[model samples]
Target: MWLLIAVSVFVGFLIVLYLASPLITPKPLDLKGVHVLVTGGSSGIGKAIAVEVAQRGANICLLARNKAKLEEAQSEIEKVLVDKNQQKVIHISVDISKDYAAVVQAIQQAEEELGPVVLLVNCAGASVAGSFEDLSLNDFKRMIDINYIGTVHVTRAVIPSMKKNQHGRIVFISSQAGQIGLYGYTAYSGSKFALRGLAEALHMELKPYNVYVTLAFPPDTDTPGFAEEQKSKPEETRLISETAGLFQPSVVASSIIKDVVSGRFFSYAGLDGYMLAAVTCGMSPVTSIMEATQQVACMGIFRIISLFYLDHFDRICRKCKQERSDPSSEKKTS
Candidate 1:
């Protein structure tokens, strides 16, 4: 009798949770006729996101430091617009990491051309990988400048307008490295991880104004940036990253867009992404009761699984260290 009573109570609780989900869930944002500004949209995942939103009928503004690449991306995005005659795409050349006044000016130009930005995608970022001791101070500073402060500058410029409008969506394209610190990513991970703190605090301040924030944790992706990152990765970092595998830029962009429209606080790509998001969820805002329940139920199991992953990574680091210390090991293997 007690066992049956316990099961009945649990089922009743789930039913109540499901019915209450809508109260906390934000209405989905429509992309049609909306203005979206994508930083770093001249290439890679940023370009892919611009194409995705263009297909949804949003006017696009691409921001990057390279005027040539921005123009090239602008033309490509225009080709995918749902309304060729009505929809428009424009590009601005500016380094978001530098001068706040310049960022504000660039945003003004975009809003003047396209209208107030309904969505802002903070995708401009940089990565540098090396042992903590080997990395130059400039490397660390550059990563923070491009990945963290750049997002700050752009978001700061847009917030007042968004608040006045009382509706907006923001996306921060942080990497899987942002979720978990790994070998050779001391500088890169620190910068990416800073995004989460900013996103969380900003979400709180903006939620009352109906401005939603989505922080995306994308795994290793096949992009020009990813290719460059690979060149600087240590052997241990490479081995650990290979376990999750590389995803295409389109896939990552699509996932991010889906979450943004739904007003999800955390966005992730792939199985590994789902696991990390759940395990690290910790006090972050939830859009639905279902999401909260899943995190509650699965976090413990995912934490256990992560231990095995950590062990494997530790083994890789030890092996790499051994090979480096004993030069003869390379000859023996050959």
Candidate 2:
């Protein structure tokens, strides 16, 4: 009984330490005069981020495959410029996924017009949803090409310039699905998961050069692309995903930019994202003292709670399979 009391007191002391230590986060990087490049900047989260950065005095370059859309996005972003006297917003038309040379050329042109890109945001991506068995090889390849390879193409083009300057910020917009693979995301999940691995490796490689890397794991946001993806998503996928609340692009983009500016390696959106990042902290570098303390103290409890979530998802999948196998199974079982 005396030992139990001692243990409880010790645990309480640790909890207090975790709660109180270093609530302050690092100061965010100044955006004034920084040359910022955003891929897939024509719409959705990318467009939102571009608008936010532009409001902060960053020189903005928006890249997408559609000239018309890029023009429209640039117009929107330009309206938010912190100073009307700064250089005009730049827009490029090129498919980053299929043409690495073209992407590189576009970056060169943007740099010439604006300045060397000190901040690069990789947001050009797409998703294809279906069961693993139902998805075609082309489906998998397309997702990988746009979501994974597209990020590579843009990042590679900007790296040399960043390395030359020895200071830069690279942000990759991954998905919550990247952290925890869910049903009907076989191809899409794989592509997003690849982003996490790339970001982690890049974070290690770029840190010494004063370049920071951030991977954003945003939950479902209200975006045009997300709406399109919903059309192809399996019923089970939609059902499972509905549990996590959908967020606005502006909200997500705001959180991402805030984290990126602070030089954080992982940028999570909303409470779901916070929980997911905390549970999956693993070997990822922790920049926030409070975040590190939370992970150290609560990971085990979160894991236990996560098992219930996994079991719920598993049950949903099983039920869906059963219903498909025998349409009358529900009635019969009841």
Candidate 3:
């Protein structure tokens, strides 16, 4: 009993010590008159981001699959921008999942119509939630193709232009699933995790040329698509998503734009994010008092604790890498 009390007191003291620890974040980058591209600009988070950027006096090029939705979102963005400074927003309709050439062409056209593209926000991504047994192989392939490959396609398409300009910012809107594996997210989580490796590599490669890449690991937010996701979420998934605050689209838009403009490498929108990020970033040691106090203590009685979800994620990632290495041999004959 004394030992428990002593440990608790020690942990409390440690937290108090680090409570005022300095946070490492970036200085704000200017956005005035900059041309920005937002993939998946039709609805949900992408549309919100477009609005935020427009309000900041930047020219925006909106891209998404749906023509009507893209037009609708474009109107909203322009209206908001006009209220701020009487400026207009450009919109392009392109199917990101297919037609890489067309998407590139549309971007070029937008550059011609609007101005030079300097900021790229890869906000367009999606996932279908389901267990491994129930989900189809084709569905899994599509998830990777859109979530992972789509990021590559858009970023690669814009690199030459950005390199010539010598200044650019790329933000990929990754999810919590990508940060930590979750129940019934085999396909979604696998591709989402791929972004971390991709962004880390690109950050190192692009830093010399004045291009900065930011990967955003946002918790669940209330977008138009939330109702659809709720249909298949399991209890654990639902709980985590809810714990993330179910924030409105506007809040995410505002905060994410702030993060991108400020050149933040990583950001958690609120309190839970701060706690979750600290523990996960140092999972090897979990040296933070936050872990020693409430987290591990809660799971003490479980004699057989397992990082089952984490192991599954690692195995699938190895499988993903093996397939990427020899696409010709691992190529789907189906």
Candidate 4:
């Protein structure tokens, strides 16, 4: 059929475009002497990212709630600095969700000590998983405060400097849960999903200023925060989430940094992460022509593939609910 031939031609064209993507990669920004501010940079993926950028010659300012942990992270990053003279590391403690004034003060102090923050990484976030009815209104509010508003506070503090400089990189650490809603993640997913909208709008608004925005969708990274989240996950949530395998924080941090430097709007780690991003490319901006071509070509196929995943997840939730309702079935399993 003519339709079949058209589809084949489109697929071939897209394959060629994807292969040429690297050739069309955006010009990478120089990080040497760049002032990089990372929120929640005391541990986990945030700490790992701080170490990476530090090694690349960016002065690092780590912000977190725990002074002791931030100090410890600062020490660790100091050990890996490529040039002691080129980059320095410092730590500040503030609860970004509640301390808007303190966050502004910390940024001012960091700018005076280091320089204006050329790169801002919003990595501070919190997650709580439970059935919707079981999660209190406070839980939802807390998730929004810590995950969404915290990002806004740091970003707002840094934007003026970046606008004045006329160049910057702002990275937001959003999870795969942000892209898709999973069971028992009502509060967490809502907060993460909000970042996508924020990042997208900023991308369009900041383009003229040459300030790039990157939203990273890291899947189930093996971080201290993730370990803590596991303790609170419902059985159904755990079973559904396990399908997306855990990744090391270093691997994820590296991938995200690569995307940031490349001026990618959406940064994803691992095969599943890439597939998810591609499949859900919907209205997201594409930095490269090749990327746009690939998304247009692959969207339909990936959507078909995603149905299988959705079915599996739905099946798990239904099975768990059924078990909970049937006392005899639950006892037998126990």
Task: Judging by TM-score against the true structure, name the best candidate.
Answer: 1
Give per-residue lDDT, candidate 2, residue 322: 92
Lowest lDDT block of 10, candidate 2: 18-27
* Model 4: residues with Cα > 4 Å off, grouped in runs: 1-26, 330-334
Cα lDDT of model 1 by residue, 42-159, tens digit: 9899999999999999999999999989989999998988899999999999999999999999999999999999999999887888899889999999999999999999999999
Candidate 2, residue 207: lDDT? 76
TM-score of 3: 0.75
lDDT of 3 by residue, 1-334 (tens): 9999998997777667467322222346677788889998878888888888887888889888788888888878878773455455878877776778987898789889777688899988887777687778987899888888888888988888888887888898888778777767888889888987888788767766677777777778777666777888654456445545777777878888887776655545676565554445532212234444444554433222235434544555555446667766456733
lDDT of 4 by residue, 99-160 (tens): 79999999999999998998899999888999999899999999999999999999999999
Is candidate 1 or 4 superior in lDDT?
Answer: 1
Question: Candidate 4, overall lDDT?
Answer: 0.90
On lDDT, the stronger of 2 and 4 is: 4
The weakest ten consecutive residues by lDDT in model 4 span 17-26
Overall local distance difference test of candidate 3: 0.73
